[model samples]
Target: MKRSETFTTVLTEAHAGSRIDLVLSQVFPEISRNQIQNLIKAKKVLMNGKVPKPRDIVEGGEEVSLEIEIDEGVSAPEPQAIALDILYEDDDLLIVNKSAGMVVHPGAGNPNNTLMNALLYHYPPLKDLERAGIVHRLDKETSGALVIAKNEETAEALQKQFAERTVTRVYQALLVGELISGRTVDAFIGRNPYNRKKMMITEYDEELEENPGKEAITHIRVLERFREHTLVECHLETGRTHQIRVHMQHINLPIVGDPDYGSRLKIPRKFTHHAENVLRGFRRQALHAYQVGFIHPKTGEDVLATAPLPKDMTTLIDAIREDHELYVKDHF
Candidate 1:
């Protein structure tokens, strides 16, 4: 069974003028700040008997209340057996190689057969944790390695590491254009005003107290170049939703097979017939989470894991490489 926990507190002088989310996080250190923000967004946090924005400043002696539902047992999805590619597992956590097209968790229009449901099926104990202990997520079209916590303490520790920007995640992507040098994209990202489902780079002044966008940073280095595309490695600095996809598109070098951000299928005239065919056949974003490194929550030691590129991506890359070789032999 699940239960709701309530907390009521009065802002002290030391907490006055602080952001509501930050103050609540300090007062309740057990809850992650991200969870606090979610609570604020869900209208579960009230200040002075009214729902307050996450960034609202609190004056001393103002009453604040929070209501959080805690799950004590597995509830939804009716766990059914599903295959998982396990990378590593321990008493505290587990790492999995998530396949492309698999939703990490269930949401609107995605009711079941998700990674969360599969995890619950495999590890019934995870039913007691939120989202089956998933601390972070990869987009449905992106395949990669992801970590899951086994207990509440490990989940909080992993969330803290992510919040502090201490976790390292490296991804491999095939972009539509050649990149001459490594570079970093530092931009704010938010929902597209015109299309609510999509994200776009936002222009915001850092000095503003309430910025609509979240800060995102991605560092990319070219690994290989073809006549019409480049294979690159991306290191994430902040894990905003669609961070790599949006950042790459912001620079006009969208990932290959990215239907939303990429340009219409227009193979370059210089591309070989085989290369064009391979590129056209790739239906999902050519992105893979290749490596991840973080500190172990229980052992206090560093843990790193890597997943090889999936078969589809590897086949596409091989075709592209063959084309590149042919171009080089003819020109140089």
Candidate 2:
């Protein structure tokens, strides 16, 4: 009913003693356990070399490989000629310069015109690989570097690194007002009860995704300060949905063009694309993924990637710096 490559998996000894069913459930969360049991009955699920029963307990020191073939047949996504700024690529990985206004993946309200669709066009065969090699994503309005895996093995390895907090992600943002040289924000971030679509810092009980609530830690440094605005560099020890934007807002120095997290005088003319007078000249959220560092999934060597600031933010910063400085002197 389905087809896929002979995907090789290596389950370490620590994972031993867990039921095979649990492994299947973890690997494929979208599919129910009942579905997995059915697949196993059909001899679709294989262990290292043989098919294993659902109740079979995993041995800690054993290696388990699975070949998952899903019938969600791939419909050749119609290719759209979307321009991509690829910064670096190797056989196993790619570092791309995602421009502002490009959605990272296919989602409601945006199915065809997405980075995933364009990537499918460029790397059609990769679609059949383990997980489409899309290890991470940048917000549509946030431009900058993003790493992509080219194969299943690499994707798995990189994903593990991300889970272990071994990968490093850095972001840059131009925020309203002055900031200190360096600081850290430690807070519990969860969905806002009043606005489910937005995430905010919470002190008490917080809403979490079905999985769990994550602790987000952010390190920030003031790169440059203008009279009223500050260019800041942020490093994430832990990444969560909208970690930087909300944390910055918690500090009362929200990113200049972010509408969702800012208040009153700082909402911006446009965001700056969606409105002009609201956040004004700054078009999109003044955020960029400027640096990413990780260990090479296959080679186990250190790898670092960087993307430069886009023109819109740079141009906006020039004006913000001058205006911010004047504001600081006059106001402060």
Error of 2 at 30 (Å): 9.9
Candidate 1 per-residue lDDT, tens place, 67-112, comes to: 9896756346657687999998999899999999999877667868
TM-score of predicted structure 2 = 0.72
Query: Evaluated with lDDT, which candidate comes out highest?
Result: 1
TM-score of each: 0.83, 0.72
State in Å the error of residue 258, model 2: 0.8
Model 2 worst lDDT window (10 residues): 269-278
Model 1 ranges with Cα > 4 A deviation: 1-43, 47-54, 57-75, 205-210
Runs in model 2 lying further than 4 Å from the true structure: 1-76, 204-212, 265-279, 324-332
